[model samples]
Target: MTAVHASSESPSETRKFLVLLVGSIGVVYGDIGTSPLYAFREALRPFSDDGVQQQEVIGLISLMVWTLTIIVTFKYVLFLLRADNDGEGGTLSLLALLMKQTGSYMPILFFAGLIGSALFIGDAMITPALSVMSALEGMKLVTPAFTNYVLPLSAAVMVGLFAIQRKGTGAVAKFFGPITVVWFLAMAWGGLIHIGDDWTILQALNPINALWFITHAGWAGLIVLGAVFLTVTGAEALYADLGHFGRKPISVAWFMLVFPALALNYLGQGALVLGHPETIHSPFYLLYPDWALLPMVILATMATIIASQAVITGAFSLARQAVHLGFLPRLLITFTSETNTGQIYVPAVNILLFVGVIVLIFSFGNSESLATAYGISVTGAMVVTTLMSFQYLRSVWGWNTLAAAAVLLPLLVLESVFLAANLFKIHDGGWVPVLLALAIMVIMWTWTRGSRILREKTARNELPLESFIRSFEKSAHPPATVPGMAVFLTSHGDTTPAVLLHNIKHNHVLHQKNVILTVRTSDKPYVSDDHRATITPISDRFSKLELCFGFMEQPNVSKALAICKKRTELKFEIMNTSFYIGRRTLIADPNSDLPRWQDRLYIALSGLGIDPSDHFRLPANRVVEIGEQVAV
Candidate 1:
């Protein structure tokens, strides 16, 4: 029986692995996969005005191919994936891992993570507008009539996309794999048939050609280099989506399918442009015959929409991570999939992205114009990721300074060059992302600084838990004791909860059984059931219960309490229990630690947070919220 079971399980495991590999190709590679739609054409556009040269074609393609090789294939797929925080990856995940490993909060690393996250959110807004516009622009080649409808159509598609986010991705995710596979195969075929147009285009495979182009092209070369950076714009998704599909599957999909398809398609574009330079305006679409042009355009539209969906979902995930880490206020998060914890919807983030996309579509009006704004956020994010990776290598992996610098410095130099190249577009449209990132960074900084001051101020005035409990128990005329259990939620376990103190003063009674509950977010992505809850007895009538949740997890207090009941001596029937929570009314104080403007901003930010009852998933009927006014 053991031998038969082992043999059967092997095939099942193999099938599951294959499924993951395909899924990763669909979701993980979507953004980068759609780059061929615009990357080559845009890179070649600046030179086309003077009549394109053969070396420029080969050189640009060479620059693009090598960028994919280094940034996406080497830096992200191989290096960053290994830095997962309990199987999770991304800027914040890496930050959490570093803090855990170093056993302290490193301010520089914290700000690096914040910058990466803010830039990513800015990228999220641009990607949908850029990708969708580029794809739909192909229709102009199908018929000049499409020139007018492109912007409106792009806006409509995006509006519809955001509308359906609440419905979840699970139902549509199965189709994503098959549709993307077809897209890749179609791209490879399009590129393969055209490679013979100029076999010399193969010279782009040599990194030396990239160097030759960069050196000879002069100042204009930097502008062209900015366009080349577009090819690798979506590379960070590979690292950001690491937890969804794991490292092996993502790497496998990249090496086996994604890279090859991208290389073939780009080489094909280079070859087509070399043989017939006039096709420069619409080289990607021109690769196909007239009969197939419209169909390819339709297919490209689907692929870009898929790409946009992946980015929008990533923004939601990042926002939730920020909330858990206390970088942002509690956002209204909706679980879109019952089986997939990662499939979430943040209404605010979705609306923000939608508004941003619409604004870009109208403001820029075309992919060529939007391209100027595109690379700043992506390159900025890459630079920040590189800095954080250096810290991770030195601190967590314990690499010698020289060894870590040797590996990261070159990448940093390359990324810095790209960042500087993109900066040239600031007047054109690049300021959109730079401005957006700065706005987000300011919000993050204000929240963190204000929250710290508020916490310090609150902590100073609160009574310690042990002292308050001991004094209450020994009081000559103690308050009357009630019959049921009461759970008072607190941020500091060592201090008495304001809600508990208020209840004793107002209700003039204490529960027969009382518990102080504190929920904490761990540095890891998940906490196992064995380490989920820690209980400590304070007295016969009172105990301290602390529930620990991972940053990636949703804290459901009732469910965790049920687990505690089964695993420990703690006993509480949900129907007979009361959950006491403090609802603070923050008022700005001119004399407080923060300036008046900052105090008001913090107060405004606090109002944006969801109620603790809803955020903690407490029973609505049993929740008792005690209001307290506090000056910040």
Candidate 2:
């Protein structure tokens, strides 16, 4: 998972800045960098046979150029990057910031974030299939003999990409910057060589051409916008990876290298189509000499694989955020990098994504077909982000309604148009992503709802902590006191944990020192170590401990308790401590508000979660679980 952690570190020195800038290009720009492979060809598909006219070619290229300029360069790099949450940015991070400024329990805001996250998963599944297929499609230019091998070869490349995820990217990550720098330089060189062929192609630089195309071409123009939307598809990554590389490094990389390279390449492709027309079928590859074709194909394949890696890493991060925020059940999360906590691997997410990509490769069979399924999810996500940004601007940034609308409305309007254009692709394979997003949304919503119901049902039977402690003090028959420390994990700090109640009732003894521990996930990407834990003495033998973690952090109860011991009066030996946890067996109640099927689904999902002791990093030898049945 690639969600960034907050830090108090200052900006890097000049030497360090140069290194981070290159690394940023490799990871942050991979997705947008590879778009030149398929975005242009697919955009002109509706006019393929007729031999696209000069004006239309210029207009489409104009749209491509300015789309990169406006949406990516201006909107993302300049505007949205500034909306970061404590130096971290992404849908979840942004949502977390908004929730902190407001409250954690807003239904409308949560629903919007859930939908955006679901759409991102859909985008994640499609990116690898589309990018790899498009790169391999260049093989036909090498020889017609390679055409039959494209799908199989694409599938293999994707399998290889996902297969390496478990091992982590740290080893090869260093080379990514240098290799991607070469890729961008190659793109710029390829376009510069072709631009001289038809100097008039420079006319596309004028915004008037793009405006004219949109206004005059009617429905075809609208459809073209959807295709053009592909150019900025992965723009979200710039914000998502803000914590990985600071704002300055990513911004410098884009403005200094990435943006210029993409623009030149698109213009070169346009010039090639204008001068040769026949090359439109494979303009990106044919821009190089015959001897360069093989090397170019190799380079393109590598670039696309990197692009896929970015999306997959993003999926891991998003899943962790969802789980931390109570929208999804706990799943296994493994840290892939010893030095970087943000570098993580989620096996379940990896398997699901690999399966989804393989199925897409077989079902769609080609880049053009996969392209139909791509734009909608990304555009949908963009729209959701814009809506959330508006809320942030108004509430967090302290902008008035008019001020917020003034800044956000134009972007929203543009994205809405792009969304409307992509909507026309529903029957032509777009339904694939829609269905994927819908399925994920259902899972998230069900898990969230079921969790709420379970908490409420348990809360009704929960004994208040103070009352229980007072009653025990005044009891005629007090339990025997054992010499040790007991730690009980609970959801509610105000109430006695069921595990504690059950433990004393069954064992007929109370430990000399008791700690009521409640672990909380805060609505932020990272919480500083200084503020991670809070301890309050409730009575002579009892203390209340609240361990707070950021949504991007994994909760480790033992480590947190150790930190508390170092900083506070609390002290306990590891060998003498006992960790008590509650386990619930849920039963479907016909009288409950939820439908019967949903209740069953909730139970099934709850069972799939990881063992609580392992999730909390508790010592298994000292842990005891008390199970009880509850109806929901």
Each candidate's clash count:
0, 0
lDDT, each prediction = 0.92, 0.89
lDDT tens readout by residue for model 2, 1-632: 23332232234466689889999998889888999998898888888877799889899999899988888887789988999888888888888888877764478788888899999999999999999999888889889999999999998898788899999988888888888898999999999999987888899999999988888877777877888999998898998889889899999999899999999999999999999998888789988999999899999888888889888988898899889988888998989898987789998899999999999999988999889888999999999999998888887879998998998898899899999999999999989999999999999999999888878878998889999999999999989999999999998999999988988799989999999999999987788889999888999989999999988889988888788878898996889999899888888899887788888988888887998898899989999889989888
Measured with C-alpha atoms, the lDDT of residue 316 in candidate 1 is: 93
> Any runs in candidate 1 off by more than 4 Å, and if so which?
1-3, 103-105
The whole-model C-alpha lDDT of candidate 1 against the native structure comes to 0.92
For model 1 the local lDDT of residue 247 reads 98
- Model 1, C-alpha of 427: deviation from truth (Å): 0.7
Which residue segments of model 2 deviate by more than 4 Å?
1-12, 103-105
Q: What TM-score, over all chains together, does every model reach?
A: 0.99, 0.97
Q: Say what the RMSD of model 2 is.
A: 3.9
